[model samples]
Target: MSSKLRSIRAGHRSVISRLLKKFEDIRDDGDEPVNTEELTKIVNNLLKKQETLQKLNEDILENLDEGEVEAEIVDSDEYAYTLDGKITQIQKLILVNTSTLSTNAKDFRQL
Candidate 1:
């Protein structure tokens, strides 16, 4: 049982770490025209990992001694929400950049 708990904790950490790295990569590449296709792939991957993270959180709570189930649930839910927000921010950034690029292309062609 202890080993199971440790595995779940490790998995949780791995997923979160990967998610943060992906997010940082996008931010670090800022001001460059993003490859929408690649960005979509990253977002899709993030979503899947986020789901896995939530599941791991559930597994963690299951292994707990049941002293603060409600609080843990709230914390996990909040964490998921925050990740969702980050995903949305990335999506919006891509949309804005794509739109700007489209406009610039049109203006250049007209000149």
Candidate 2:
């Protein structure tokens, strides 16, 4: 990773740690006793998700480093799509298919 990006990520981690510390301090020493276990659980879950995303990003970077990304764009003169049209099209797609289907599958679709 680039040094600049690494520094920014470190800064974010520092800020999050500080905020979590402050939250625990408030929960530990407040006028009235408070339950912060749920909040702690949420914070931990968020941290886990962050780590997982970071790992995914690293994996993606490694894959990209292996080769260049190929992309293409094309412009076409097509009719503008509307929500209702798309909904109807999707309904038809789900309700039936153009090809063959099994009897059990057809029965399930009826149900």
Candidate 3:
């Protein structure tokens, strides 16, 4: 049981570390025309990992006592909400940057 718990925790940490690295990469590339295909792939991968982590967390909580599980659930929900918000912000930034690039391209062509 302890080994299973440790594995779950390690998996959770790995997912979170990967997500953070992706987020940093996006931010660092800010306003530069990013490859939309690559961005989409990264986002999809991150979401899949996040969903898996959430499911694993739920499984772990099911084995714990009510009070302890409740506390963990609250924290997990808050973290998930924050991650969702960050992802939304990143998506919006990409959209805005792409639009600006498109408009600039049109202006260059007209000149």
Could you say which candidate leads in lDDT? Answer: 1
Which is better, 1 or 3, measured by lDDT?
1
lDDT of each: 0.72, 0.43, 0.69
Q: Give model 1's TM-score versus the native structure.
A: 0.64
- Put down candidate 1 lDDT per residue, 1-111, tens digits, no spaces: 635865775676577667667767866886765667766777787788777877778777887777867877887788788878878987886687677456536355544
Cα lDDT over the full model 3 = 0.69
Better of 1 and 2 by TM-score: 1
Q: Rank the candidates by lDDT, best first.
A: 1, 3, 2
- Writing each residue's lDDT as its tens digit, candidate 3 over 1-111 gives 635964876776677667667766866875765666665666676677678768877777877777787777887788788767766766776576567456536355544
What overall lDDT, based on C-alpha atoms, would model 2 receive against the true structure?
A: 0.43
lDDT score of model 1?
Answer: 0.72
Question: What clash count does candidate 2 reach?
Answer: 0
Q: Where does model 1 exceed 4 Å of error?
A: 2-6, 100-111
Report each candidate's C-alpha RMSD, comma-separated, in the order given: 5.0, 19.2, 5.0
Backbone clashes, each candidate: 0, 0, 0
Worst 10 residues of 2 by lDDT: 71-80
